[model samples]
Target chain A: MQVFASLLAGLVFGLGLIVSGMANPAKVLGFLDLAGAWDPSLAFVMGGAIAVGAIAFFIARNRLVSLLGTPMQLPTSRAIDRRLVGGSLLFGIGWGIAGFCPGPGLVALGMGEVKALVFVVAMLAGMGLWVLFEARAGVSK
Target chain B: MTIAWSTFTPWSALAGGVLIGIAAGMFVLFNGRIAGISGILGGLLKPAKGDAAWRIAFIGGLLIAPLVYALMATLPMPQIDAGYGALILAGLLVGIGTSYGSGCTSGHGVCGLSRLSPRSLVATAMFMAAGFVTVFVIRHLINA
Candidate 1:
């Protein structure tokens, strides 16, 4: 049931990305191009998502288990440390360069974009490197 | 910044966002999970017992989304201006950063902000700010 829900969630999420103009790197770049002709559409996308998500989260917080009886697994970390800040900065720089974050990258890949193949493969490799480096650092997640 | 009125799609963007939120809502409400793309993909990197199945299932759905969309209507095309070098560089950064940062746009930007997580708030601001600065450098300073 959870697996089915996840698949459904992913499908809907990808459709939303398509519908929201988020799957379009040029449009995403338009939002980030603050010095250029900026598109304010992405802001509305985030706002609309948050408006509905906030309500769902509010209800989620009060629940002990999910509707499918799975354990709630929201993030537990609150530390605004170097990894969080630094990693995000790096990610942002990358996003600005290519306008492909993880989600859109995957969505584009699903659409069979060769460019997205490069991004996704490199992303996986980067994650692999993190695993290797973090393992050496005696950290595991 | 001048408003790009031509491409400003407030209505469609909002509707799509609602669909995304609904998807997220369903995940948390039914499955007790956050629909964060990077985190889910990251988990697949080091598959754990009894955990890898759903992650694969989720990603599989993502991988097949385009075909589904094509069946409904004419698929929209997204422009990719970056070359191979830039694409690879960006991908590596996104992979490492999302792993180290513990989330990406979907996880931290959408779900995290929705849950009012302070950590996500900071992460979101950091990425957005960095995105703004990077774009500034590339477009204005580098004169790309």
Candidate 2:
């Protein structure tokens, strides 16, 4: 059941990307080109995302447990530190330039786009680097 | 007639983002895990006590989603300007960054922020900053 839902959700996500024009790197790049002819589509995308999330969160907040048969693992930490600022900078810059963030990058793979492949490859490497650093620092898994 | 952007009838990327948030929330609700790619992928590296199957399943689901979509929609192909070497470097940088920060955008930005986590706020900011700087460097400074 978990597997089914996850896949179904992913499909819905991919479909959304396709419908929203996010599947096209050119569209994303165009939006980033403020100096040239800036496209406001990304903003619409952002707006659409925020709207859906707001309602969904409100509804889910009342639910005590998830359908997956386990308690939701909500983050308890609220620290505002260097690590947080640094990570957001990195993510945003990457998104602005590459025109694909982690989620869209993964979904872009289905498009068989070479650029998406490059991004995913790099994304995987980024994941590997974290593991290496964590091991060296003796961060308990 | 102006189209109302609020309702999102056809459901834009914003709709997708909302679904992603909802999915992340529900994922935690039932599975007790954050919908973070790095964490899930990281778990695959160590394969700790009874924690390999779900991680694999999660990634597998991500991979399969596109193939399924191809059947129903007209999927667009991505064109990569940079070479393979540049891409490898970028990937490594992101991996290192995620590790240092403790999680990816999805975990921190989507899930964490939804829960009003200050750490996520900072992380999201950093991720954005890094992306912006990298682009500025590549496009303006380095001329890549």
Candidate 3:
């Protein structure tokens, strides 16, 4: 049941990505290009998403367990440290450069975009590197 | 700063965003998970016991949705202006960065902000600022 719900949610999310024009790198780049031909459409997308999400989160906060009876695994970290800022900066730079975040990147790859494949492969490699470093550092998660 | 009003589709964007929000909302409500693509995909790298099924199912849904959309209308072909080298580098940075930051646009920008998380707020601001600066440098200064 949990798996089915997740699948349904993913389907809806992917449809939203496509319908919102976020799956297009050009559209994403247009949004980020504030100094050039700025597209404010993405802002609306964010606004709409947050509006609904806020309400849902409020409801979730009142609940002890999820609908499927699983314990909520919401993030509890509150510290704003160097890792957060630095990692975000790096991610932002990458986003600005390629105009492809993880969701849209995967959506593109699912559509059989060759460049998307390359990006996904490279991304996996990068993630692998993180795991390697984490092991060496003995970071117990 | 020229606003591209001609190309903007506010209505569809908002509608689509609502759909995304619903999906995310349902995801957390039902599955007890954040609808973050990077976190979802990243977990598969080192899968825990009994954890791989839903992740794969979710990703399969993502992969299949576009194909379903193609049946009704022509799907938009992604137009990436960056070269392969830039794309690869960008992908690597995003992967490493998201892992370190513990979230991405979906996780931090949408879900975290919705929950009024202070750390997420800071992370969101930093990423947005960084994105703006990176674009500025690339488009104007570096001329790349």
Candidate 4:
């Protein structure tokens, strides 16, 4: 049952990415291009995503337990520290340069674009680097 | 009104994002795990005792989702304009960033922030700002 829901959710996300034109790197690039032929369609996409999320969270808040089983786990950290800032900076720079974030990066791979493949490869490498560094420093994820 | 509604409608990206958020929330409820791509993928890379199953299942689900969608509807292929080198570089950067931050946008921004975590708020802001700056540099400065 949980697996089914997860599958359903993933499908909906993939479809949403497809239908909303988010799978297209050019469209995303257009949204990013504030000064040159700027297109705000991505904003609409982001806005729509937030609306659905708000309602969903509201409903989940009222539920005692999740559809799967346990109560929802929320992050307890309050420190606005370096890891947060540095990560965001890296993520944003990548998005700006490649026009593909993690979610869309996977979806882009489905499109069989060679560039997405490259991005995925590098993304995985970066993950590997982190693991190696963390292992050396005795930190766990 | 038209602009706002169109932007806010479920038919737009907001609806999809909301669904993603809800799914992440529900997954945590049932599985006690955050629906973060980086964490999920990372776990798969270095599996621990009794941790392999869920990670594989999660990634498998990701792959299977599109295949199922293709069977149901015509999946439009996305066009990527960046060169091979640029794409690879971007991916590597994101991977490192996810590790350094301990989460991705979905884990931090959507899931974490929704839970009102200050850490997520800052992370989300950084993600947006980084994206903003990256786009500016690429489109204006590098012209790539």
Question: Which candidate's lDDT is highest?
Answer: 1
Worst 10 residues of 2 chain B by lDDT: B1-10
Question: Ten residues in a row with the worst lDDT in model 2 chain A?
Answer: A30-39
What's the TM-score of every candidate structure?
0.98, 0.80, 0.97, 0.85
lDDT of 3 by residue, B1-144 (tens): 799999899999999899889988998999888888888988998889999999998888787778988998888777878889999999999899998888889999989988899988898898888888888899889995
iRMS of candidate 1, Å:
0.8
Better of 1 and 4 by TM-score: 1
Candidate 1 - CAPRI tier? Answer: high
By DockQ: ranked, best first = 1, 3, 4, 2
Query: For residues B5-120, what per-residue lDDT tens digits would candidate 4 score against the true structure?
Result: 33322344555555565566556556655667777777667878866666666655655555666887887677788888888888988898987887876677666655556787
lDDT of 2 by residue, B1-144 (tens): 233344223445566555565556556655656677666666676677866766666666666666776777655565555566665565555655665566765667666666556677678667655654565566667774
Which DockQ values do the candidates obtain, in the order shown?
0.87, 0.40, 0.84, 0.45
Q: lDDT of each model, Cα atoms only?
A: 0.91, 0.61, 0.88, 0.69
lDDT of 4: 0.69
lDDT of 3 by residue, A25-123 (tens): 889888888998899999988898999999999999888799999999898888899989998888899888898888888888999998988888888
A75-119 in candidate 2: lDDT tens per residue? 555666665566555556556555666666777775566766777
How far residue A52's Cα lies from its native spot in candidate 2, in Å, is: 2.4
RMSD, one per candidate, in order: 0.9, 4.5, 1.1, 3.7
The residue pairs in collision within model 1 are none
Ranking of candidates on lDDT, top first? 1, 3, 4, 2
What's model 2's overall lDDT?
0.61
How well is each residue in A1-141 modelled by candidate 4, as lDDT tens digits?
655555555555556666666767776776676666666776656555545555555656666667677555545567778877887789778877878877677777766667777888899899899889888889765
Chain A TM-score across all models, in listed order: 0.98, 0.88, 0.97, 0.90
